[model samples]
Every structure is written in C-alpha cells, then in structure tokens.
Target chain A: MIKVQEEDFDVGQEIKNLTQENHAIGGVASFLGLVRDIASNEEISAMTLEHYPGMTEKMLAEIEAEANRRWELDASLIIHRYGRMEPGEQIVLVITCSKHRKAAFESCEFLMDYLKTKAPFWKLEETSEGGKWVDARDSDDTAASRWIET
Target chain B: MKILYFAWLRTTIGKSTEEITPPETVKTVSDLLDWMPSLGENYSSALEKRDLLRIAINQEYADPEHVIKPDDEVALFPPVTGG
Candidate 1:
C-alpha cells in the first residue's frame, strides 16, 4: 500500500492492517521519519513539504515495486505526508513484511534510501529567521548510491 | 512544450508553469536549460546551478541528455530532499 496525504496517520493501525491478512509473514520491519526541531543551527518552527502531485505517487509506487523485486516479501507499505508540520510530527513511514526478518529489514531500509533521493518531494524549513528551502544533503545521496546495482 | 518549476525555482523564477516553443536547436533537456536563462532575467539566477538542477520529463526523473518533445511536461528543480 502507498499513500500520500496531508493528514497524520496512525502507525499502529497501519501496521496492523499490513500484517493481518498474511499468515505466512514471520516478521515486519518499519521505519518512521519525524520532523526535527533544529536544522543547520537555526531553530525550526515548522516545515512545509511540497511535491509534484501526479509524480509523487508514481515515484513512490516505483520505489515500492523495486523493493518487492529485490526481496521475498509478502507485503509493504509507504505513507508520506506533505504540507505544514511542526517538530516531532511524523513525516514518512515504511513497512515491510516477509517470511523472515532479513528480507523485511533489508527491504525497509532500501525503500527509505530510495525515497530520499528518487521521491519528488521538497522540504522548506521555517526558522526564526524566515523560511528557506532545504538543500539536498550529500549524505542522503551517498546513502542512496550504495543501493545502486553495479 | 510545457515547463514547470518547483520549490525555490518556482519562487525565484516567479511562476509555477508556462508554455513555450523552443527553437529547433533545443533538442534535449540540457539544451532547454541553456535556452531558459536567455528568455528572462529571473531564469538566470533561478537556474544558476544548471548542473545541479534535476529534471523530470513527463513526470519521471530524466537526465540532461534525455530527448524532449513539444507535448512533454518538463519540470526543473533542485535535488530532491524528501525521505
């Protein structure tokens, strides 16, 4: 399942829905990203996330498909929210369920790494000074690069 | 062709979308990037980091050398920062 929305989601409910139908799943791995209070020495008051409407969903679906292609998984879910959010608010969630722990773990991580680089979303930090667009971090690119098939 | 800008590119360029027909010389995305700044003063600074800007042709990530058509939707923005 893949969902892009403006409202916050219930992580517990989502995980339950993902694993309830699959009796073959032995393990589920999930990751949740939250908005930070501090960024680049400035105290962030809020964050505004923007995305290409049609493209965002398409890119996320492709990321999910790639994860399933690489791992033996029964199910996977990705929920990403865009719009104004405050510190500690959930931003994204990735969940993977498989017959074993390894596939679930690895694929969850892979989905996150790909989403960081390939997803068509941008974040703007609203700080004490004013709002500024967040630059793409080199670390994110490096993390995503490791997943590339050689 | 339809050109779209996002995030800082949209704010800096002062518009979200526009329609224009490029000359025959602008065959690829890189050529379009080079041609954009010449169209207006705002584009010069908005597109300062021409090499760093990411392109999406018809809603998928595309390279500078990607071929473009008059009906395609071309978007230009900075490197993605989402997770």
Candidate 2:
C-alpha cells in the first residue's frame, strides 16, 4: 500500500490494518520519519514539503514492486506526507511484513533507502532567518547504490 | 508539450507550468535543455546548472537521451530530499 497526503497518520493503526488478517506473517519492521526542530545549529520552525502529484505515486509504486520482487514480503506500506508541517510532526512511514525477521528488516530498510533518493519530494526548512531548500546528501545516493546488483 | 517545474525550480522560473511548441530539431531532453535558455533569462538562470536538475517524462524518470513527443509532459526539478 502507498499513500501521499497532507494529513497525519496513526502508525499503530496502519500496522494493525496490514497485519491483522495475515497469519503467515511472523515479523514486521517499520520506520517513521519526523520533522526535526533543529538543523545545523539553527532552530527550524516548520518545513514545507513539495512533490509532483502523479509522479510521486508512480515512483512509489515502482519502488514497492522492486522490493516485493527482491524479498518474500507479505505486505508493505509507505505513507509520505507533503505540505507545511511543524517540528516533531510525522513526515513519512515505511512498514514491511514477512514470515521471517530478516526479510522484514532488510526490506524495510531497502524501501526507505530507495525512497530517500528516488521519490519525487523536496523539503524546504523555515528558520528564524529565512526558508532554505534542503540539499540532496551524497551519503543518501551512496546508500541507495548499495542495493544495485553487481 | 507541457513543461512543469517543482520546488526551487518553480520559484526560480517564476511559474509552475508552461506550454510550448519546440522546433523539430529539439528531439530529446538534452536538446530541450539546450534550447530552453533562449526563452528568457529566468530559464537560463534556473537551468544553468544542468547536473543539478532532474527530468521526468509523463511522471517517470527520463535520461538526457530520452526522446520527447509533442504531447509529452516533461518535468524538471532538483534532487529529491524525502525519506
């Protein structure tokens, strides 16, 4: 499952909804991203996330499909939020369920790594001084490249 | 064709979207990039750093060599910063 919205989500409720009927699923791994109150010693008041509407969903679905092909995942979910959000607010979520812990854990990590570099979303931080767009980190590209088949 | 801009690109270009009809010589993403700067100073400034920009055709990532159809939707933006 995938969702792109401005509203916040309940993590516990999402997990329950995905795993309730699945008896074969033995393990679930999830990750939640939150807006930070500070960046580079400056206090951040808010963050505005921007994204391409149709492209965001399409890329997310492709990423999810790749994960399913690589692992034995019974279910997976990715919920990414856009628009203005205050510090400590939930920004994104990724959950993977499998019959074993290893697959669940690894796939969960894989989904996040890919999403960070491949998803069509941008974050602009608003500080006391002014708003600035966050730069893409080289480390993120390195992380995503690790999953490429050699 | 419809050209869309996002984030800082939109801010820099001063518009979110625009419609244009390029000449037949503008066949690919690379060709379009080369010709866009001629439109105005804003386009030239926004697209000055070619490596910093990313492109998508009809919502999918496209390389510089990707062919552009007359009715295609092309988008240009900076690298992603989402989780």
Candidate 3:
C-alpha cells in the first residue's frame, strides 16, 4: 500500500505493520529521508515544498509497483510530506519487505531513487541573504536511470 | 488551460498558476516557452534557459515536441532535487 500525508508517522509501528504475520519475509529494509538543518553559509532559513495533488501520489505508486514486479517484495510503503518544513524534519519514508536482504535493500534504494527524480515535488528555501530558488538537480535523473537496467 | 509552476518558477513567474489560451499555431510545449517571453519580463527572466527547465503535460514527463492545447494542463519545474 502507498500513503502520502503531511503528518509525522511512527516508524516502528509502520514497520511492524509491514512485517507482522509474514513468516516468509526474512527482513525489512527501510530508508528515512531526514531533513537536515544544514546551516551552511548558504544562508537558508526555511524551506517550503509543493507537490502536484493527484500526480505525486500516482507517480510514487507506480514506483512501488515497479519495485514489486522486479523483486519478491511482500509489502512496500512510501510517505511524503508537503507544505513548509524545517530542517531536521522527516521529509520522506520508504520501506520494503522481501524474503531476502538483497531484494529488500535494492528495492528500498530503488524507491528512493525514483522518488528523488520522477516524483513531482518542489522546494523553496529561505536564506539570510534573501531567498533563492533551487532548481532540480540533473544528477537525480541520472540516478534513477541506472535502475531501469535492472 | 491550467498551468502550474513550482520552486524558483513560483518566484520567477510571480504567480503559481495561471490560465491561458494560445493560438492554433502553437502546437508543441516548446512553442509555449518561446511565447512566454512575450507575456512579460518576469516570464522571460524565469524562462531564461529552456534547457534547465523541465516540462510535464497532463502530469507526465513529456517531450519538448509533445502536442499542447489550450485545454491541456501544463506544469513547469526544475529537476527533482528532493531525496
């Protein structure tokens, strides 16, 4: 299942829900994208993120489906937040459950990689020297493309 | 005719969303970008470089040559930097 929300979730509870009663599942691999308040000399004070209402969720669901098709995943979850968020906030969470560690690990990373590039989300950061707009990084696209080979 | 902008685009466009109807000749998304500079200086500034901007039509990443219409919902943004 896929869930996209602005509220913070209990990571432990979510993991338990994914792994409970499934004896065939050997391990659960998860990745949490924590927003770091990197007080770089870049002068960024606050950050605001925006997403396409119907599109964002759909794209993430597609990514999850792809991972499931490639690996023997029992369950997968992706949750993302929108609106104004401070540094150190949890921006994204992805979990993958499979019978083997390799599939779980690879699928978790694959989901994050796809979300970083394909998912529709925008970020606006406020800095001391005035706010500057951040463009999407080309490197992210390259990162996601690597997964298509597998 | 729904147009969506995000990130620096929101600042550069000075507005997040707008509705517009273009001429019959403007068939592709590239045509829309080429026409945006004429709308105002702010649009020209934001669209300074077409190479850096990404385009999506109807919520899917589209080619520059993709057909566009006044009824289509087009979105513009920079590449994904979020992790």
Which parts of model 3 have CA positions greater than 4 angstroms off? A39-44
The best candidate in terms of DockQ: 2
lDDT of each: 0.93, 0.96, 0.83
Taking the tens digit of each residue's C-alpha lDDT, what string does model 3 give over A1-150?
A: 777777877889999988897878898999998766554447556777778777887888889999999898988899888777777788888999988899999999999999998888877777777665566666777888888774
Candidate 3 lDDT tens digits, B1-83: 88988777777889989998777778899998888888889999999977888898988889889999777889998776665
Candidate 1 stretches with Cα past 4 Å from truth are none
Query: Tens digit of lDDT per residue, candidate 2, span B1-83?
Result: 99999989999999999999999999999999999999999999999888889999999999999999999999999999997
Cα RMSD, each candidate? 0.9, 0.7, 1.8
DockQ of each: 0.88, 0.92, 0.67
What is residue B70's positional error in candidate 3, in angstroms?
3.0
* Best first by DockQ, ranked: 2, 1, 3
* Candidate 1, A25-101: lDDT as tens digits: 99999999999999988899999999998999999999999999999999999999999999999999999999999
Candidate 1 vs candidate 3, lDDT winner? 1
Ten residues in sequence with the least summed lDDT for candidate 2 chain A = A127-136
**Fnat for candidate 1 (0 to 1):** 0.80
